[model samples]
Target: MSSKEVDVQQVLNTVGEPTRFRIIELLSSRPHAVGEVATALGALQPQITKHLQALEAAGVIRVHRLGRRRVARLDRETLARVAAYLGGLARADEDDAALDDYQRAIAREETRLAEGDSTRVLRFERDLPADARSVWEAWTNPARAAQWWAPRHFSVRVFDFEPRAGASIRIVLAEGDAEYESRGHVERVGAGRLVFSLAPVDPAGEPLFEARHDLVVTGEDRAHVRLDIEISAVREDAAPAVAGLRPGWEQLLDALDAFLRTTP
Candidate 1:
């Protein structure tokens, strides 16, 4: 093979076995004859020989005739290649921001899941550089909400919304030619708080689950927001939606934060 490349996975599989790893570790000190290696590890000669043959096939080691006995030594170049391959994988993860987001969601995991095993509760908090009044408008006003209502990769069209007890709420989120509808009503809306229930419908026009949102905004010159979401009435086919709820809301909140900062 090329000097710059090696079958690292094959070498891993070969050395991954316990006995093979022990044999390689034994040889690392210096080349050893087959019988000497078996004697060092207290393993049978035939078993050690079989492991040595697999390692040889994977280019992890080389066996040579030393006078009358056969001796095996590690191939330094192949082992170096495996180290570089693993280093590259570690660097790739360092550049991924989504991994940080997932870590944040995991940190917020509840002490105990809902008793019924059919409901999930999620909580999130963000501090935004805007007053509570304007942040409230961003959520309730269609003209303002349209700017940052949907998550990434979706555009929202607000058809109806009334900020009062028992008023109707409806919005359509479109991703290219595909459209989704969310319908519900306000439980209460006042000052800097909104309590509402929303159900995002599926393709067959069935509600996925009932999500009750208790969003509260505080602080004067700058807003401190807290949101508690409880999801229930989960339908059988709502698996994907349930899994995505935390990430989806994370994106939406980020969008709102950006929109409010840049708005006139």
Candidate 2:
């Protein structure tokens, strides 16, 4: 029979049971009658017999008449097919490490969350299609920055974004009918590096948290960018923003990556 023809889910569901798993383990060594299995497990014959019937119906085991008694053994074909299916999942895929990092960050933040005034650090790295100069320009240039600074489905309004030290910065991102205003200033700017801080307020004009961002861009032809961000002064009302930090940054990076690919 073909691989697709195997009832892998049924077999898995049947063997997933604790008692049935032990029964399969017992049968793996050799064929066992219901009474013998019951004796080995210290279980009643009726319970063992019922389990055997389920295993057989699910193609996890095969039962046959042996000397006026039923004997059960592992159905090797069905199990081997399941093993093959599981083995296929071990193959590698692109961006898997990024996905794993995001998952780990989520777990770590969940464990570290507390009541008030919490702080969180986020690190993000990406290799882009554009050169370091172009990438830096995209950040420093107000028009270029406006094109890609916001996440998907959001519009950006930049009040001011001067790259020099102590330059005041203000930008607002809007989604649907709501807007989040980011008010801060550029702290330092040098060759392919920028340090800035943003204190974003929610739609209701309530202060959430202040995020300090340190960004570095390097390489030629292909740029490698790193962002180290510290989110601090978290308020009680900003828990939802903290929870969505990873996914939200992922979307913004996605927007940047897309913008770089299409730009000169």
List candidate 1 segments past 4 Å from native.
Answer: 1-116
Distance from true position, residue 111, model 2, in Å?
7.2
Every model's TM-score: 0.57, 0.56
TM-score of 2: 0.56
Question: In candidate 1, what are the lDDT values of residues 180-238, reduced to their tens digit?
Answer: 88888899988788999887887676788889999999998899999999988776556
The total number of steric clashes, by the backbone 3 Å criterion, in model 2 comes to 0
Which ten residues in a row are the worst by lDDT in model 1?
107-116
Predicted structure with the largest TM-score when compared to the true one: 1
Which digits, one per residue and each the tens of the lDDT, describe model 2 over residues 182-214? 778899999888999877777666567788999
The per-model lDDT (C-alpha) reads: 0.82, 0.82
Clashing pairs in model 1, backbone N/Cα/C closer than 3 A? none
Number of clashes recorded per candidate: 0, 0
